[model samples]
Target chain A: MFGKKRVAIVGAGVTLFRRNLKETGKELSYEAAKTALEVAGLELRDIKSVVMGSAPDAFDGVHMKGEYLADGAGAYHKPYTRVFVGGGTGVFTPLAGWWHVASGQFDTCLVVCEEKMSSCYPHPQYAFTTIFDPILERPIGMNLIWIFALEMNRYMHKHNIKKEDIALVSVKNKRNALDNPIAQLAANITVEDVLNSEIMAWPVQRLDVSPTSDGAAAVVLASEDVAKEVTDNPVWIDGVGWCIDSTHWTDRDLYYPDYVECAAKMAYKMAGIKNPPKEIDLAEPYDPFDYKELHHMEGLLLCKKGEAPKLTREGVTQRDGDLPTCPSGGLLGCGNPIAAAGLMKVCEIFWQLRGEAGKRQIPGDPRTGVAQAWGDLMQYGSVIVLRR
Target chain B: MRYYQSEAVETKDIKEGKIPTEKFRPKAKFAWSAGIAISRFLEELKNGKIIATTCSKCGRIMVPPRIYCEKCFKPADGWKYVKDTGVINTFSVSFLAADASRLKEPIVVAIINLDGASEGMGIVHRIEEYGDWREVKIGMKVKAVWKPPEERTGAITDIAYFKPIRE
Candidate 1:
């Protein structure tokens, strides 16, 4: 899709997602970067540029987090840039690296994403309080869950969707996580278990939420010539797109994500996907919450508006289903370290595409897939399409 | 292919200082300006009235007034006093606080679309005077329960909470 040089992902790596990891964010970044380099059969000297993606500095309790993480991301005295778009940093980081290679500016670029939510005192959720407007929303004493609860409630009301339908997403994802070695919340749970779980807010139950976690993920991107030289089976980055809605989230209807649809449309146009459900063999939309998977699927144009829940009910999104979704178990089952979790979805797509997923691999030899993330006051969407 | 590795630490490790952790409590606070449009809105609240901004371009009556109309990208034309009464667009019975602490009493939060404001323009506030959240619904009519004029500051809390207009 590039005039100068097509970009391809040669290697990818992910660290274990957990509540508290002894490794610092830099150390985690180094571990993932080292693994990706090793897998790509490339050395630090071979990398011409570096890209880092991390969420708010408040979570890490460190300012200028990009500069702080440079050495760890293997950017010592090299051209390095950091990407932050709330939770979209993960997939977005690789897109930045793609620009470097696709523009023919660099032969190879190393992309790393890391988050250490465990560093925050008391709880990580406290850092999110600062995300709201101090003049209006902050004074109301909003917990992060409140926004999701409000959106979930509105979504349910608008579509006349049942809680039973939403709970199925949690059940499917958690069960899918059982096969993933690095997954944190992989469990054999039921829709009843989700409904009976402790309610954080009226509509959001404990099981509906993804836990705060610490981890890192990395990937190696190279130009077409370099990709063929380094690896025989390189997964090409077919398309990339991102879009942000107005910061005034309250004024807009929260029933569905218009931004995600805009982003997917941009990507689909680039990938030449006229019909998403028919052309895209796999999907890994962000699933920080159970219903979000359905929300994002519709946003990605994988199904009709409000038709995602019905597909989930019919088991169409299962790993073995016609259209496999979140075969990595997603953030709902896997831990969510914000930026790192998004990159993990990209890594999952790379693995599934190359037939390296082992137990989590789908039966069919899927050739095309998309990974997407939503972030920032529920106003941002980042998407990437990969093909073998 | 071999992949993924990390060491998990327990809470006691940090509490006992076994993990070599440094504790931080941020004191870098700021007194943010209420800006041009909201400064007047907050001032009106001090006088026990709710104010909104009207955009001549898009013709939107926006609550929590902004200097510019987001849709048309033009300056707002004028201001008007919106009624303190509205309908609940959406709400949640939150059992947890900002710090992830379980609250002794669950808070009922709602986004209320003010009566003189344009459609879909809502301000977030608390829902009160109801015994249970089950009594609340998306379309329930509500009115702002303002604090006494003397107790009011030019802040969002001037209206203590929104209660049911019916009961």
Candidate 2:
């Protein structure tokens, strides 16, 4: 929480998100880490510490995976730690890096996140069955799609939201992803096309879901002094906070993403911002599901409750619109590689703050941005605030 | 994307995923990691015994016990054995095998909170001799059907499944 140690992102790198890559998890991590080091104009020896993240060892079919990935990420002979929060790991990785530098303990930290959802036999979607209570939830033939559809159904029923309104997010975000080089499902489509897609779950059509992907992303974070000497544009890590609500999701209200609200409050307070929509220029809220993006928008205070959907249709969330949301084409359009999706959001913020996002840049000179990821039984929210 | 224009199921090139074929590699052995005392307990059920641990600080009975009680912020050192019989807290019939693996016959996987354990301490297990999986329901009484002594393997499958108590 100290103000003077200011952690800044000097460079960022990412591998293309795809269904399958000949690369293993370590290879993916190495590819991204190499790009980040090159972009930062530094070598492996220049990094002082390391922060690694991956969603679950179950998906990679390798346990203690962070340790296994250390050498490839250039963490050998360096202070390293792994942070996990299911899907929140991607965002949590950088937050761990921020603490390493902000604590005046380390000058530079390599933040890397990798997810390989293809290793599990059969469809990797089967792995999500284990996320629920093995006793009550699992025995009922429950899968991740059911939970998402349930959330979508509840969100639609409560606010008079429609299938068409939700489809707009898929249309908007996928269209935006066309500019992202790492994007896996970037496409130009209309709401009509989305509605006609195969229905996985009643309310959740296949198009509503993010593509399962294998990918990795990394960013170089350093203290103020080190950042100033490394690059002309350093995106500062202004505030970071994460929250986890009770795992008993049935006992809580599904209409609002309360965990996200709590996480946003903690982050907003640290960033010294009282107004989110007016003050924060860009936001990359998690969009593993199209409705989730809208749900998190309200939770992140970008709009009032139930206002996110209406706001999106009004073009308020477009790149040149009032408060650009998911300008990097979120998980729905880009790709959702489990834990790596969150770090991708942080990279988007870095690119936008540095004015390096060529075709995806938000209008005007944006100074502050927020990135968030929420997952794990729909209970955890990881939020980060950035500035230049 | 691989595409087919058939109106029927085609099984070719489905990646016959019974263990990957990195082209004829030996099956490597694996071990469950630390904090698997619960896993060990499930394995021990092959001997027709149930195990649970008691927290030294809070004294709550844990089944498939936790080595550490997160509530007390310390290790749960005291351990005890529980009876294999337990009341069903909840249960369900799994109709699909995640990735379309038909169960041949759908299986009944029940979560029973064993006797003398915490309020909701239990494990999911198959229900043996239930005939139809649909017959199993919440609150049904079931007992551990242990494997024969000579055929024990120290694993969840060793318990066979939970069969209804004979009247």
Candidate 3:
């Protein structure tokens, strides 16, 4: 939709996704931002604007967290803004950065995403309490797992999908994570292990969910001219789309993500992609939970409704499969630091497109890929398409 | 780029106080006003009634009543009482507490779509009178089990929980 100045991602970097990192949230952002600048062959002085994406202020236990992390994000004296749409913030960060360059307002923009989930006391899950509707949903003392389980149950019932079929996603992602240096829960396990894992909520087990983590990711966005000077191969930002559904989650059917489809359609329209399943080479749909990956695949129109499991069973989503998905291990395998997880997907796409992913790189030299992130009571979806 | 790495910390080290940590607990508490829709809804709840707001334009009877219709972006036409009975839209048996601690007994929570409300419009609440978790199925008929009037309060908890309606 943005037919103005073309924007390209010239550089990307990410910190290790872990349970507890000694560095503060700002330090993490600085580390990722510094690395991104180095890779882009530019200094902090060259950046004209900065865009910050963080999941929640509660995760860092810092109010007005954007301002607090601004200096570390290389936003000193620069026009900076924070974009938040729960976990969707990561890809949304770059989308905001794209606008800075596409609008001809800035030649170079630094996009940073960070999440320090360990800072929440007792348990990080406690911070999620506020995300619920206080008078309606919160009064019943609801936890995050309850909602995921509820949705999973509905999806399974609608499709007649067994828990074992969904467990395959966890197995595949964890095994894939074994190749990722920054992965937290990368493992070699069978679907049996996932099915046998401790049940946090029925149909939703411990192994099925992504771990709460602390990490940061960053990328450098530049206009066509700046991108040409910075790198010989630039991952062009072809399209960006985001959508949000009603906060009244109970008022809508949970079987399908209509919002995700809406966002994907918007992105596809901008990218001029008529057939996502055929045209897109690879994908990284948000997978906070195992079933969610499959749910999102359907939402992104990568596969038909209720047919993702069959494709997954046929190994169509493997790293070596025809349409590789989540080759960077994804949030399930890589570790979910909320905003950073989504940006991590974007970073993976960058490396994969440039054939620099080393161990995790897919066999084929894929040219186009899509990364999406979802969050906020299953209300928001953010999508980005990148072309080499 | 190949040499890039991030620093990590061990949980044991932080637990042993090996790292300097600053503790700050926020005392910030919020008293949110329920406003016209929810205030009246809560009053109705105390009177053992489930109320919903209807938007004349879109004809959506929204639960947890709102002053304005979300779809039409117009003021809700009026309030209407919904049946205490509902069907289970979806449910879960949670073994974890709100604080991530293990619970001694699992609680069955469900989103129950009330009869008189618009399709898919429902309230989230606990389910009771079911011993086996497997028995709780979607589309099962349920009715609100309200607390006695003397113990009733103008809150969502006033209705207590919903139980399966006997055939």
Candidate 3 segments exceeding 4 Å error: B1-3
Candidate 1 chain B minimal-lDDT segment of 10 residues:
B1-10
Which portions of model 2 show Cα errors greater than 4 Å?
A: A1-4, B1-97, B100-167
Pick the DockQ winner: 1
Docking class of 1: medium
Show where candidate 1 strays beyond 4 Å: none
Better of 1 and 2 by lDDT: 1
Clash counts for the predictions, in order: 0, 0, 0
Error of 3 at B152 (Å): 1.0
The alpha-carbon RMSD values of the candidates against the true structure, listed in the order shown, are 1.1, 8.2, 1.1
Q: Mind sharing the TM-score for model 3?
A: 0.99
TM-score, candidate number 2: 0.75
**Alpha-carbon shift of residue A89 in model 1 (angstroms):** 1.3
Q: Tell me the tens digit of each residue's lDDT in model 2 across A82-185.
A: 88899888898898899898989899999999888866666677867778765334544665665676567667766878889889999989999999877889
lDDT of 3 by residue, A165-283 (tens): 99989888988888888999999999989988998988789999999898999999999999999899899999889999999999999999999999999889999999999999999
Question: Interface RMSD, all models, one decimal each?
Answer: 1.1, 10.8, 1.4
Which pairs of residues clash in candidate 2, taking residues 3 or more apart in a chain or in different chains? none
lDDT for each of the candidates?
0.92, 0.79, 0.91
In order of appearance, the predictions have TM-scores of 0.98, 0.75, 0.99
